[model samples]
Target chain A: MATAVAKKKKVRINGCVAAAQAAKYADVDVITAYPIRPYTATMMALAQMVANGELDAEYIVADSEHSQLSIAHGASSSGARVFTGSSGVGVQFAYELYSPISGTRMPVQMMIADRTLDPPGDFGSEHTDALSARDMGWLMGWSCDAQEAFDNHLLGFRIGEDRRVLLPQMVCQDGFFVSHITTDVELPDTGQVQEFLPPYTHPYPLDPRRPVSHGPQIMPEQGPPLQLERARAMEGAVPVIEQAHDEFARIFGRRYDPWLEEFMTDGADVVFFVQGAHAVTARYAIRHMRERGAKVGLVRLKTIRPYPTDRVKDALSKFKVVGVIETNLGLGSVSSGGVLYAEACAALYESPTRPLVVSFMAGMGGEAIVLKEFYWMTNKMLDAQKRGAIEKRTHWVGFEE
Target chain B: MPAIEIQRQMLPMFPSPNQGARFYNPELPETEPFVPGHRTCAGCGPSIQYRMTSKASGDNTILVGPTGCMYVANSSYLCTPYNVPWAHTQIGSSGSFTAGVAAAYEAMIRKGKWKGAFPNIICEAGDGSASDIGLASISGALYRNHDCLIICYDNEQYANTGIQASSRTPYGGMTTFSPPGPTIPEAKKLFPKDLARMMAAGHPHCYVATASVGYPIDLMNKVRKGLNHKGASYLMVYTPCQKGFVYETPRSIDLGRLVVECGLYPIWEWNPEKREFDYSFRPQNMRPVSEYLKLQGRFGHLHAEHIATLQKFANEQWRMMKVELPAALIRAADAKNLVDMASAEAAAAIAETV
Candidate 1:
């Protein structure tokens, strides 16, 4: 069921600006942020929006990342739609609040422009920052480009604000790559956005007339029931996520697979399983590889939380081998690889005939996963399929002897 | 863009504590925000302070209790005693979390999103949390002028953690962490920080005040005044810790009164409207420092010189409050006028073995 599209203006903007535009269009009630690289640009854009009077909202420059998240949580709990973000260790700095915000079921949206966590002194994009919090009861995913990042922010609001699934969302984009790169982003008409996403209101807000205790300390025995209810909300978000995406596509004419994006899996013997902007490069590499009569494709993971176990199992089952491009750091993992390898391998563990899965640590430290590296990773997977076994479980793509 | 409408609250600006001269129950909101059947001690000062604060806040309130006795004991085994909305934040997040709640309400109530009068957002932090780890965050909240109230329920030391000495712990006071030892005979070497005055000096615009659980009506009134200030406010209440102070359970409120009377805890308010410190508060029946110190076992180890040192400290507090020191208090301020702790036998007999 599709509807007539609205007037869309094509504007060239960076990923940070795209996210700020999405936040502005969403008409967020409160925006709180602390300065961290890559993600700081988004706040800069938003601050300018507020300064220019283009956005009528409360923009608070928090003392720290912890305060930013706290402000976001408080604002959200008070029945205001709030937007805040951090990058790198800035994300880790606010680690204590991730659960409290989610546990309370306040739909706070955090725009994460992934930056390399420090000690290495790099400002490139890496998934580890947001990936580390994937299990913290937040709905999270990545966008390949600015347009998707913008669209995802809108979809995130709808999905998270739904009564059935009132959870916070992490709209992540790669640092510098998607966040800094300028592209032609189609801005939706304000009326169309209004029709798609309306103003947010929490059912149990801290209202003088209707007061409710949120995140109250529960007894040990009472813990299980509340946790189970939170689990239920997450599990229930599956239908809500699917419905929102379907509705998002119909209204905005931008359709996306809410969970996993399949680039080319038709009759492929081997494929690349990647996430974020790395998948965009994987697409180019796969197109050239296919022209060489190589049966290779790409399986880009969009949603990393409430992980699409059944869908991943079905789509990846058709391949003979899968190369998991982990743009994140997951030390002591099953594949001695990245964390995504475990999720991909777990979904395939119960398969009738599981493919040979190999981990390739690439696109880390904000370094681009070049076409040659994709070729190198593809050959590793193809070699595994032909040998019917992985020579090794994980490969540090450029480090392998 | 449409003209953003300004919403004025119809709620009372300050708390309406019932006026009385005697120890009568202050007219409080009917709703028991701090319900009974909690695990705080029989005469826990902080628990009593919690009751008064929650009563002042009423139904439309959100309480942020940093990790402390109020957070752990009051909500023991997940059995919360709160009738109104309450949250537990990290010890250091006392002010930051409260600032968040206050800022949220500001946007929500003003943005035509949330309806009704603004709810009171209050943070109840322990002395250790407020005067120690949470000082900067509290300063930040006050500096930002968020519409919230930050109350440091000062039990003198970190009583919840088995009486570890905190920055607010008085000089010569004994705690698990500051026991009288060979090198440090006076127990805690330094004087207690003048926290309320520090907050008032740092955040002059805030409605800052020093209060005590001993005076229920005044404490509740100050709580209301802070909440009604329409901006950030800080209150530090002298909540006696029977467990830590090693006093009789029944004397918790009595200790609260003795503190003010002895000038150890002078009650005063910072008037932001006139940008002045209102030192108009006066305690009835001024007593010497010995009257307050002799009641607590923690100070029982103090010698004549130590007690006189405390008296001197109390004198300083009175001077800051602009109160003339009484003759007995002035005499007690000198070691020569005080007995040598019965020639050191009391110090030897009362020194905690720990």
Candidate 2:
């Protein structure tokens, strides 16, 4: 629905810089940063923005990501729109804060340029970093490209800061795929962003005049009610997310399905179920395969936590087989390794004629699942449909048998 | 003095109902700045300190709980207990976060984003969080002179993560990691880091004080004083943990008094403007270190020598505070004079042997 609006200005920039530009356009009030690869450029851009007087904000170069989030948590509680980002292990390094920030309902937004977890020390796009934190009460999702990344950053603020949702957001994009890649991302004017997202104001913020104790110690029996409240909030966020996206479209001329992005899934015999930049590639593969008259499609999951199980089950119920592409490491997990396989299988367990799903370790270590790999995965799915069973639990896309 | 006239007032024969020892939770506004139903442990002493702290700050207050037990346990499950606005900072970000909150309020109030008399910005940090991880950041906030109050609830050990020895943990105390064994007889051999005094000595321009929960009125009064101070103020309060201290829950406040009376923890304030220590406050009685040690299992393993060493340390603390020790206290400081486990033979030895 986005229209070409009055000859857009073009600028050459990387993914990190684009994210920084999005944060700048969002008019973030406080920026907390700790240097880590890929995502560091975003903070570096913000630092320059602060220095050049392009952004009138408090730029805090924190000692660590733990400190960075704490600063953001503090700043946001003081009613400032805060921006922070981390990459790979840097995200894990700050794992301690994920729940505390959300629990306090500070609505802090963090941009994570997904990097492969260490052991081999590869600085590449992988979902393992952010995926590890999916269960921590944060609104987590990944963007497929730079424009989506930019849009997601703004939407994340809107969704997280919404009174009904009041949760922290982990807006992720692949490290090199989206974080380093350059693309034409239309920058919304400040007025449009303002209309799309209101200035964050918590009802009971750390205001001295109306002192409230945030995150105080509670007894054991008291824990369930609070957790139930958080659960209710997550479940309640469905309509809010839709309304936010609808509002974003009305104001910014960019339309997005709040939950799942489906491509040629109607009447498809097999579908690729996945998230992030690889979904873009899968879509391309789907198009190529469809041209050859092989009934194939893609179902890109936009939101992971608050996991959209009902919508996913509805979408994939008709398909004979579903291939799950996992760009993450699940170490010793079931389904021969990847985590999404478990999530997808579990989500489909109660469905009528549940699809024959096979886990594909296609994007492990950030290796791009090439066109051939997609075709290979699709063939595996097709084989499962025809044979009524899968030969193996998982298939490493690029590596030989 | 007129004893007859004093008696004519018909005071209660026992401790009077209105005596200083009695606790009356101030006629606090119905507003609960720090509300109940948090994730803190049952009978948590530090949480009690937080409750008292926020109650003193009242409606117009911003609380900053740095990363520690308070931030973790209290704010768990995304349900905050704060009726007012409270934020959690990193264990090390207490001072800096507080400074930001204070700065934000100053700018907001001035810019008309908010309109009110400046709210009391208070940062409540645990001893481990404050004295150890957060010391430099707190020092930075104090040095920057932010209009805030930073209270280090000194429960000695890190109680939230089970009992662990913090820099503020006293000598001869037994923590999980600092257990008493045959070789290392005195569990924690090193003396506690003189944290509050160090804060006062380092940040002389800021209002610095040491308080205990035993003196609630004094604690509340100090909270008000810190809020009223034009610049940053630091208060390291002795809030005993019944769990970590291995004492009866009801004795939590009692330990606070015993800690000060034993001279292990001194209660005083530093007058920034006058540039002097105010030793105006005093405990009711001076007691031996054993009186405090006997209450907690952490100090149970200490031998006579260890107790004497602690007593010597307490004597040195008394001297630093310029408190003139009585002869009894000086006699209590000597190892030989102090009663050992088998020392009943010294006097009144006509005992039936088991």
Candidate No. with top TM-score: 1
lDDT of 1 by residue, A140-220 (tens): 999999999999999999999999999999999999889999999999998889999978978887665654556655567
Q: In candidate 2, residue A261 scores what lDDT?
A: 94
Task: List TM-score per model, in order.
Answer: 0.92, 0.78
| Interface CA RMSD of each prediction in angstroms | 5.3, 13.8
Task: Specify the CAPRI tier of model 1.
Answer: acceptable
Model 2 / residue B45 / CA error / Å: 8.1
Candidate 2: tens digits of C-alpha lDDT, residues B1-354 = 111110001111222221144356444435567778876766577887887777777776777877777787778755777766677666777876787676555444443455657777789999998888878778777876878899999989888787889998899877776766658877787788888888889989999998888777677667877887888999999888766777777787788789989999888999999999998777889898999988776776667778888889999888988899888778877778765422323111211110
Model 1's alpha-carbon lDDT is 0.84
Measured with C-alpha atoms, the lDDT of residue B245 in candidate 2 is: 73
lDDT of each residue in A345-401, candidate 2, tens digit only: 888988987989888887777777789989889888888989999878888777754
Give the true-contact fraction for every prediction, in order. Answer: 0.46, 0.43
* Residue-by-residue lDDT tens digits, candidate 1, B228-341: 788899999999988788778889878888988888888888898898988877776888888888877788777788888988888988887778776888898899887643
In model 1, residue pairs whose N, Cα or C atoms come closer than 3 Å (at least 3 residues apart or on different chains), thus clashing, are none
